[model samples]
Target: MTQPYVVRYVGGPLDGRVDSLPATPEVPRQVVTYVHLHAGPKIVHIYELSYAVEYGCEYVLRVEDE
Candidate 1:
């Protein structure tokens, strides 16, 4: 089986070199795991990665209220 594609966030508040995960929109737990392993604990969102000219998203992380 192919490994799950790692989503990359671009533009917006998350410009670059800012390891700050905002507290507004809670990030998904699974995505958080990926981020914690890769980006760290300051990343909030993980959108689906796209290579085509037209953008597309398969699925996004959604954390249940705790």
Candidate 2:
């Protein structure tokens, strides 16, 4: 069994959020279908996994064109 690890999220509505997720054989490059419901229509956000020396492993929200 693989050990669980901590992953940080940046950008989007989930910015500055940390979560512990179960280990998978391969970590997906991007996480999709994150739904956020407010007073209006639900919004969907996608976060991409990134690695850096300073930030380590984190998921950054994908910026959409306006």
Candidate 3:
């Protein structure tokens, strides 16, 4: 079956080099397990080389609710 999700190009700038699984509105920060980037019948798949998350400053401020 065709996948219900799709990857879109969101052009912007990050503080440093950043690369990870394709993200969607529902799964923000979700590391992608696989992807198909080619158009039409052809397809491509990509998997994570690493799983990562930030645990400092930004994450610290949000911990008060916990």
Task: Name the best candidate (by TM-score).
Answer: 2
Flag regions of model 3 displaced more than 4 Å: 1-39, 55-66
Candidate 1 pairs with clashing backbones: none
Which pairs of residues collide in model 3?
none
- Worst lDDT window (10 residues) for model 1? 15-24
**lDDT tens per residue, model 1, 1-66:** 443433334443332322323332344333322343345556555433333333222233344469
Question: Comparing 1 and 2 by TM-score, which wins?
Answer: 2
lDDT, candidate 1, equals 0.35
lDDT order of candidates, best first? 2, 1, 3
- Model 2, residue 27: displacement in angstroms? 3.6
- What TM-score should be assigned to candidate 3? 0.19
Clashing residue pairs in candidate 2, if any?
none
Identify the runs in model 1 with alpha carbons over 4 angstroms from their true place: 16-66
Using lDDT as the measure, name the better of candidate 1 and candidate 3.
1
> For model 3, how does the per-residue alpha-carbon lDDT over 1-66 read when each residue is reduced to its tens digit?
433323332221211333333332453433332333455674433222222343111101111235
| Model 2 stretches with alpha carbons more than 4 Å out | 1-4, 22-25
